[model samples]
Target: MPASSHHYRRTVLLLWLAAAVLLGLTWWHVFALVSQSRAKELANAERDLANLTRVSQEHANRTFRGADQVIRFIQSRYLELGNTLDLKALTLQGVIDAEIFPQVGVIDAMGIYTLSNQPITGKLDLSDREHFKVHVTSTSDALFVSQPVLGRATGKWSIQLTRRINRPNGDFAGVVVVSVDPGYFTRFYKELRLGQRGMMALYGLDGVARALNVGSREEFGRQANNSPVFARIAAGEEEGHYTARSVVDNVDQMVHFRKLPGYSLMIAAGLDTQSVLGNHNAAKEALWLQAAIVSMLVLALATALTRHLRQIGTEMNTRQRAQRQIEERNAQLNAIFDLSPDGFVSFDNKKRVNYISPAFRQMTGMGNETLEGVDENDFSIWLAWRCATSTPFLGVAALRADLAGGKPDPRVLIELNQRGKRVLQLGLRSSKSSSVSQILYLRDVTHEAEVDQMKSEFLATAAHELRTPMASILGYAEVLLNEEFNAATQHEFLNTIYVQSKLMANILNELLDLARIEARRDRDFRYTRVDLQMLVTDLAHTYPVPAGRSGLELTLPEQPLYLMADSGKLRQTLLNVISNAFKYSPHGDPVELKAWIKSTPNRAPGVCIEITDHGIGMSPAQLARVGERFYRADTSGKIPGTGLGMSIVKEIVALHHGTIEIDSAPGLGTTVRLCLPTYATLQDSVDQDGPSRSKLDHAIQDTRPAALS
Candidate 1:
């Protein structure tokens, strides 16, 4: 060998010896440090285990006491409401009100079960549970707490506590059970400060751990029970931490298990042995790192891990608190809107409905049909329903106006048809501050409008009736008392005075009859079977035509008009029209009376009366204003008359279920047509009370007549 090679070999040998010696010393020191650390860890773990055991026992005791208290409370409630608990007579709502927990229920021995706020009421059997059997058989007053199990009704995991109740005869009176979720208990575990790679688990007597961190719960339960520490706890012998092979990673782990008091359950906590003997691990890594820079970063790794753990904890607490606040606010808002008086609706940014208040459903008469996730235009069900019940309420218009216009300051009104007789009014207003909702208000104003119109008509009829008769009586009395006439003239004057007095009397009688009819409000027409042709003939003969009249013609149809009607009102209506024409134009032109029966297309048969006269016809303006009470047109400068003629005629025609129409022009003749519904019986009139005839009558009654002369 070369001298250089021989020298390098010696050097290598010495370096190898130094390296081996340093590694051995480092290993021994780290071993000693780890032994001390382990001894201290065991002492600390024992103390922690004892504390945990005491805490767990206290927790279990408190929970047991709480459950017992709940049972006592339930027993008191049951006794207090014993009369209400009769299985055969209990109502669903009553039971719901009587329930102690909003999320739980009770089943009596009679098989009657009561769930809180539920709409179901009936008998139910609960003899199928193992826990119930235990509860019934146990001689102690202590509650029998069942292991965590899945609920059949809600499919949720829960732990049940059952206690038997005794009757007056010392017989079993069924059991009161309280169920709580294990997850609720799991929330307490989050406060445990386990080191890196540390974990805790809870296992039931069924050999199933309800929860685990990284491994399958089933596998953990199966293998963990076989572990030395778990075995010690199962036998009720373990008191402190001990080293064992981990069920998941096959590495050594320091573990502790505590048995739950008076229950077939256990809680286990475990930490990785590598993490527990951290000094030894650090020393082993340090030697290797002296030769490699990668291992030298161990200290930095520990620092980073600590920081990350703290950050994660802080974030979790923040998120949990925020979630709680959000839940509380949401609940409060729901209560406010649900009980609000106005109809309320909320929409999302996409214009999809999100919420609707109870008032909305009550006002619009909607049920169960979801408005959420539906396009505003697709809400035709509400639209059609609103149109049927009240005025149609138009929805908020467009997104551009709602979003870009600063707010949802929108208003709309819609008219609705109700049964083809009444129209309703609905008003909708969108919130000015919120773009997400709109409010609707519906009002039934039909009766209000009727009342207003009746008031106006009553005042008008009273004034006209009172003034017309008083004016005629005063005028005729003045002419008679003044004696402004000779023998021949006096005769004419006296005759004129007599006619005026009779007209006055007729006006007063019409007013009195109208008032009586209104006070009775009886629509029942006293029908009498009579010869219709004779009635028409007598009416025509009763017409007071002037002597030496100007070719006045009276024409009637050559047929017997046999009909059932309120003959008195019908006769009054006919006479009012005939007398009006004569009083307006007695000498200017001949009067013509025509009668016929005609049935137009899609109409019932009715008698038609037309009275026309070639007289001083009224101008359109004068005719338009004539129907108004005491309203005399300016064209009739010297006319002596009461304006009640047309008004009375309109009222009489309406009561008889007939219609009146007038046609006239300036310097032309005037024609008045009246169509009286000729029903065959009183029943026919009652059934035909549809607005078709009333609408026609209303229009005719609103029409103006010629100015009096």
Candidate 2:
């Protein structure tokens, strides 16, 4: 082989060896992690199974113990009744007369049905019943439970409990049986759950599942004397697990079984294996996906490495023959670096600055001749400058590091004041060559900050000035209305003053409210349970008097409603709406106040208060801009008021955690609707403290609203 081909073969071999080693290491690490994770999951599953088994056994014991106690209590009562048979019959007769007989009927030791307080009367054969049969056959005086059977007298599905009795000669004489309606068992297991897709059933001594198995009644009377579960129980096992197909859904399930304490019955709770192992199946799928990805990545990386080695081999073979070409290429690269707009530098492993272009010094505000001997690691001067100027250079360093790790980050815009009042934006990058150096380009952005500052200062001054006079005017009007004055002389003047004052106040408040909201300050919330009906009635009474004075009618509902909300805020919202109605409508136009609860689909219950006025209503275009601060519908200035009532209403409603909607027509009428949540109690209305009084209101002139004359 030629010398070049020999070197090429050696390079290929090294690449292959490295790829193989890396692939094996990666596979081992991933496999070990997956295996350890799966083992922990399996252990946790086994522990959960053990806990479930213990819980099921305890539940079964409690149920059986309760049943046993009920049987014993009935047996003792029956024995006592036997001694006073006459009195027992009298009480049974009285119960039947009263038409509230007991659910169960008791029998005496003589096998005679002494008391049948139930409405269904019949002489029944005690020997034929399973409860009586179990009692008579047993040698001991133990409580015996029988298989579920149809009662011959009532024809209802029932289970029976019985007590054995003996005659004076010590020979078995008869039995006392207490019939239990199977409905009791149905109710007992109705709420019991094994899992999302699991159910429970009770099994008897005869291997037959009982009525407790919900919705499997057809198989009740069928013989089940040879089930695997019953066979194990008969072998004296207290508990076991069996894989069986459920009769209800015909799905295979793992049934956990427990024998009831001192009872022949057993509880079988089943969980579908597919359902129980859902999360495990999901995890396994994820692992398989990861393994496939790992294999593909390994193949891709190996191919890339092979290609890279081939390229390096080609370069090495031509190195001796192209010495002049390599020098020329290096000169061209140096020229490009020096002429570039951004800072550029190359550092060797020892952290010494190997190469830096003029652009680097220019961008960093450094002298060009002094950079060559400087250590790149000693960058504290640059960091300190960044901190002093509040320039975002530390973030630039982090951004460059992230870019090196194959992350896509945006060019950062930094504000820097380096030796002048100029701001700079830096664009940083790490070379793809895997060399230990970073590149950066920076520019200025001082004009943007000046523009933003102008906007903030304008809003603050304008809002403060407008609000001061508005509060003074509104507050004085309120004081005049509240004081006892000469009614005939000053009423009209005061009313006019109040109306104009309200309009001015609303404009000022909206401007201030919007300004504060834009500043993102904390909102004030007050909770109070207001009788919604009372509020509506008061508003209606006020609206009609004003409307009547202007030759108009006001309509309202005749009932009371209640809701939880900030009353002051709600009043402000209402005042704006009522003011709007009076302002836009022609004198004598009817206004309607309606309050009702709206039941919204897929939303919380809402209480709505609506004000409607019939006058020269607004166009759709005007209504759309109604909530904009200082937004005027009619610029003709014929309307003698500031156009901020609706806007203030919108803000106040928002502060009260309510929503407002407007409906209007050019020639018909306008309606405003406010929906708020109904407070269930006083606690629901307010936060931990009661309604908070506004400190801002105290600082400003008190703008108390005047009551309607």
Candidate 3:
């Protein structure tokens, strides 16, 4: 070959070699990235499984604790009342949640199944049952959870939670067993919506499965001794995660297992190995495709460079394309900052604002304000002006001084008076990156602050209300105990103490009722079709009239108005309103209650109950604060009330999907109207196939006075 041709051949060889090296490096990077991605996916799956296992373990522990409480309660009651415990009545009265523990029974000392919340068909001997035998032989009061067994009394598959019941002298009386349905755990697991091959199981330390749900299949009393989790437990591992084939179905999975802290049971949650890696596998394939494209582009670039040895224009175009890609990435980052809910402000190295996220502008109520390139100190002054005078902000000077003094950036909460008031948690941090000097973050915390304030106020009001009655009770009791008095004087003091005690009890009860209503949100209420006319009449007749007062006067429409409501709660609401009417009107004015069918354009047709009381009516301000807790319109010492009655009434009415309107003046008396959806209107709103519709249908078919009442 000629010298020039030899030189060209050598240069081409070097170019091909460089392209080969680049392709190899590209593949290596892709493989490393895919490997890391796979590891991350597995780690995340294990973390999720561990968290699910922890939740299941907690649920099981809570269930066991609740069952033990019921057992202890029954044991004490049974020991005191003996055969007169009335388990069935207690169950009916909701002293025990029968839905959770379907059967609670007492086995006599002779091993006879004597009493139970569930019906007993015949004399059933439970002597051979492990739950019964364990308690009978061992005097220990430790709760014993038995393997799932077919109950003789209830004729259902249940796990027996039993405790040994002893007499007052510590003599063994019998066993108190609470039967829990294993399906309960499985049902709850279904709600977790684990993948089709997911598994959740509650197993005893002895390796018996109390409840196991694999996808949709449920099993109990299955032996899992050969499982890997059991081996780990045997090796003293309380909790762990491992990938292994399941002994039950031979499906490979990543299993996270945890042992209940104080119980013998263990909970395990498993995600199918293939399902867990599904996303990672897809990503790996995409990464390989991208690597192949990059390799092709690298080879093409090498060939182009070898052919066009002196091409400067091609190099410039390549640089321009790379610049465009960088700009695109920057735009993406900017989009993310703009979309973030938390406000962010970045200052350039000069400490002047370079970027302000949309969220930051909205948080500061500075809409359309040109804040870019503004000095940090000037921005701080503007923010200070926006903040409430009550909570002034520490300006940028203080923040910089702290940072210059080697202190951490200050995080402060500032309240803004603009835009209907707001609380912002402000945090500042110095950035080490060359592009920015500092970053400011603002988070809206107004809701949290409001909640804290409401809680504090409620607690303070409760304490003050309880303290007044408590002081009266303590003073009278002390006087009676220490000083001798005549029989009449002693009786009067005793009466005073009794009244004060009752007042305190009423306050506590009303507070608890309010809390329950708020927490449960009417889940505990039993809904039924109630006759509005009949209910009002019953209230009028049953109300305890004061000495100088006439009973409530009733006005009812000719046709009966029916409503879908929890009758007990509705009755409580009406009683509260009527009682308030009488309590405020000490002059014996008869409260008039009128019921009629009402309709509104914005709502469904409903029934309205208007109760008008000629009482010491409230002013506009007091009426505005009517439903506020512990707010009484009459603050005079003559009235007797906890002031929580209206609050409870409001909550109950709202739970029924009803509205209440109160109209009053200083002397014109007050008219309170309760508008509740009619049964027919509510039935129309309910789904056709829903249980509520069926219940409403059944109620409609049965119109007897007994059913209505």
lDDT winner between candidates 2 and 3? 3
Q: Model 1: per-residue lDDT, tens digit, 305-408?
A: 33443443465467447644532100000000112245656655555677777766754556776787775566534565557444444444543355346532
Instruction: Give lDDT: candidate 3, residue 484.
Output: 97
- lDDT for model 3 comes to 0.82
Stretches of candidate 3 exceeding 4 Å from the true structure: 1-342, 352-386, 392-398, 405-407, 679-709
lDDT of candidate 1 at residue 214, scale 0 to 100:
31
Global Cα RMSD, each model: 43.6, 42.3, 37.2
Question: How do the predictions measure up, each by TM-score?
Answer: 0.34, 0.36, 0.48
Where is model 3 poorest over a 10-residue stretch in terms of lDDT?
A: 328-337
lDDT of 2 by residue, 1-709 (tens): 8999999999888877877775666556446645654554444444444445455456555544545554455455455445343323434545222122123455555455654434446666566566766665677767776677887766776666666765556667466555655555544555554455565666677766664443333234434465577778878888777667766566676677777776777766666667666665675566556555655665667755445444434653464355433221000000001123555565544444566667556655677455454554455245345433455456544665667675433365555456655455555544545454555455444455554575566456556546755666666577676876677646765666666566655555556555554444224545555666666556655654553445223344333344556676677677777767776775667666777666555555567777888877789788777875556666675766555567667766665567888888987888888887653222233334442234222322322221111
lDDT of each: 0.56, 0.57, 0.82
Better of 1 and 2 by TM-score: 2
Name the regions of candidate 2 deviating beyond 4 angstroms: 1-60, 83-102, 107-117, 168-173, 181-190, 211-227, 234-236, 240-250, 302-709
The candidate that wins on TM-score is: 3
Q: For candidate 3, write residues 333-450 as lDDT tens digits.
A: 0000112378989998888899999988888878898889988989899889998999898876676677688644466889998898789888777887898999888888887677
lDDT of 1: 0.56
Q: Local error of candidate 1 at 533, Å?
A: 4.4
Q: Is candidate 1 or candidate 2 better by lDDT?
A: 2
